[model samples]
Target: MNSSFPRLVEAVTLCFMSLNESCPRTVYTLALRGPLYLLFAVIVILIVIGNLLVICIIIFSQHLHTSTNFLVLSLSVAGLLLGVVVMPFSMVRSLETCWYFGKVFCNFHSTVDIILCNTTVWHLTFISIDRYLAVCHPMEYQKQMTNRLCVAMIMSSWSLSSVFGFTITLLDPEIKRKETFHMNCFGGCFALHTKEIGVQYSIIFYFIPVSIIVTVYSRIFFVAVRQSKLIHSYNYNPKAPLKSKGFKATKTLAVVIGTFLVCWTPFFMCNIIDPIIDHSVPPLLYEVFMWLAYLNTMFNPIIYSFFYRWFRETSKNFWERLLNILI
Candidate 1:
């Protein structure tokens, strides 16, 4: 009788365990899969389309071969690479909440990701400084800003980005390790006391670039206002309306600076906050901030199209051809 009673209890417990095991799978399929899968699809589509448009416009337009446009082209290429190569894989991991891509791919992804992101920031900084010089010292700018100098500047930006990014890669092996399940993960690199390295990276990657951007833009704004005043003072034939070229240029610069601030501020804030937060930030919030950072890539082309008449005309022509074909 005692043996029969023990067996009956064991059988009931086994059945309960089996039900519990299946319940989560059922719940996940019903509750989590639909929304997350749809969201991921939408994000991927937006990123691909937005970046593709930027690339196609740059490639097809000969007028876009200017120094500024060259920087923009580099930025678009990097963003496209990031969108296709890194973001999709990241979205996959976020969906699964696991780094399933092993250590090798993980390190490579981190390296490329850092390099591209830093390059974008530095390129913007360079643009800001270039515009400042052009506005504040127009004569010197015309004399000194040769095409060769522009190419050298672009090359220097990428080389510096590579150095900083590769430094992080060298440290990555020490910072992350494969879990027992073979998932690669962040192992508290930011949490521990690595104050000197953190400060150095912060200075190089964030502080200096941002400072240069702000300073240059400030000077550019002042110069623009002064130039506009001088233009207003000049006597013109009553028949000829005065052109507000300086004001218009300043307005465009403002848009560029504003977009840069809006798009990048969230990312820099996230970097600052990550180390301070004891618990992990909600994944959704992290993703929102990340996409906000990436928003710069999409916004840049729009800024160019809006501020530069040439880009607008080129983009319109490209779309018109496509529309005619589709029709």
Candidate 2:
């Protein structure tokens, strides 16, 4: 065995200092700490500000307020919480490899991670269902997706995710002790699941939601295509851009769903497979996939700003106001 392995592990306990008296005599060198912290800082800033902007746009733009936009706002809220609650600390842990935070915090943090990520997935599912109704059953969409219904869906998503997350943490000791010190290094946390738990989480939370999203979007696109054909066949040029805008919204959401599913698959696959292989996976690879999943949250608001008309208009107005204030 290479003698350097232990040092490498020890060195990972970088810049994060805690009051743990029994902490190993391992700290990341000055050279490594700077770049790592810089990287995390940029990521934290991006996710926070971008998602905040998304929330602001959805909330303040009255014209944008609808069942669909509210569902989007709910999803934005989850992404915001994930960024604010999970990302900064996770960045520290991923780099430091030491759980300087105490036992209680370890459990709380891991539970938050599980709950919020799962909630985001559920939010996406709700969004897909909403879009399906809007496009596939346009006449009934408004009645079916009332404000009360949207609120119920959001509440249900969070409630189910919380129950599932807390239950997993309670039943699975591995998750409860996710952040801790390794024998060779300090703060070695593994949120690795058992085979049964892994399978359940991957299938129930990730795979099922993804399938719903894909299926719903397929149906939505079919309706959109049919609508477009009808418009062309009749040469019916409507005065308002509402119908064309609706189709564009469907296209934009399709992009969103596609991007999310693409980013989500690898993480779920790893979650399912890693523990079944008794966690023989490389830490570097695991970290890569986890961060890649993190990027989904980061990308969502950016995607909306690029593709969603309301988001762009609201963001433009927001920036203009800020600039006026500065001036």
Candidate 3:
């Protein structure tokens, strides 16, 4: 599956390259320039700032270092790597409209991309399961979500993501080979195959994770609503001790899940549609959607800040200290 997938990607890449060369002077190419540059800048800045804030919040605030927070921190780290290591390459690819970085860099770039992408989804999956346990079975959550287990889960997530990503690197030799600059170099056979692989990836990396998140969060919402109703019924008293906190936390989780869905849905939808639709999508359109998926990394920290007070406060403190040093 690993080797075959890259071959497929390569084939698809060649097809697209052919189409791109043939249509270089088309309306699509002319329309892409300004927006693509703007998108590149915006996405890079957002991802850098957002992921940095996440890391700062996690690092400086000792109280925020719970097992759940650790998972979030790991996610932030992956996001940071994606922003720094992956986004620049994507920008370069967009500007050049070809893989000028040769085969080795291409392989490494793709490897990093896959690893980070998989890590993001897997982290979300792990978090959803954790939240489910916490909300549905509080006693068991307290027991099972120990520091040791948290570490193990994190390690497992990284290891599993790495294994899948590395498999792709090992399977595709052409991924590491520099191709001659033929007109067909942009999107030929290899490119078409890549497109198919992208569609399949939407199923593997996106649809499955989304399904898991939706199912888990749906159950969580139902449970929380039921519990809230029960609490309200039992206590005619105006002040219910846990009501506010529980409600706030549930709302925060909902926002987190919602942000993930919003950021990723368009990209995945494009992947699914591009394969079915025979007409070539504008390169700029693909670039826009690609950055949209990349925006997921940037939004996580912002969502955390908005929804979680501790993260917001910690971020403020960290920035204040940095400014103090600068001053």
Q: Pick the candidate with the highest TM-score.
A: 2
Q: Give the C-alpha miss distance for residue 316 in model 1, angstroms.
A: 1.4
Question: What are the per-residue Cα lDDT tens digits for candidate 1 across 1-327?
Answer: 355432211111211233332111111232464677787667666656766787788787777777766777777777777778877776655444444465578777777777777788888888877787677877898677778878887888789989977887776533332232121223111111133444466678778888888888877777787776677678645565444665576678789778878877765666555445532455446556666776676677667767888777888898998899999
lDDT for each residue of candidate 3 in 39-79, tens digit (9 for 90 to 100): 77887888888887787777878888888989998998999
Off by over 4 Å in 2: 1-33, 175-186, 236-243, 322-327
TM-score of 1: 0.76
Can you give the lDDT of residue 56 in candidate 1?
A: 88
lDDT of 1: 0.65
| Pairs in clash, predicted candidate 2 | 97-187, 98-186, 98-187, 99-187, 180-188, 181-187
In order of listing, the candidates' clash counts read 0, 6, 32
Q: Pick the lDDT winner.
A: 2
Q: What is the lDDT of residue 288 in candidate 3?
A: 71
Per-residue error at 45 for model 3, in Å?
A: 1.8
Q: lDDT value for candidate 3?
A: 0.72
Q: Candidate 3 — worst ten consecutive residues by lDDT sum? A: 6-15
| 317: Cα error in model 3, Å | 2.2
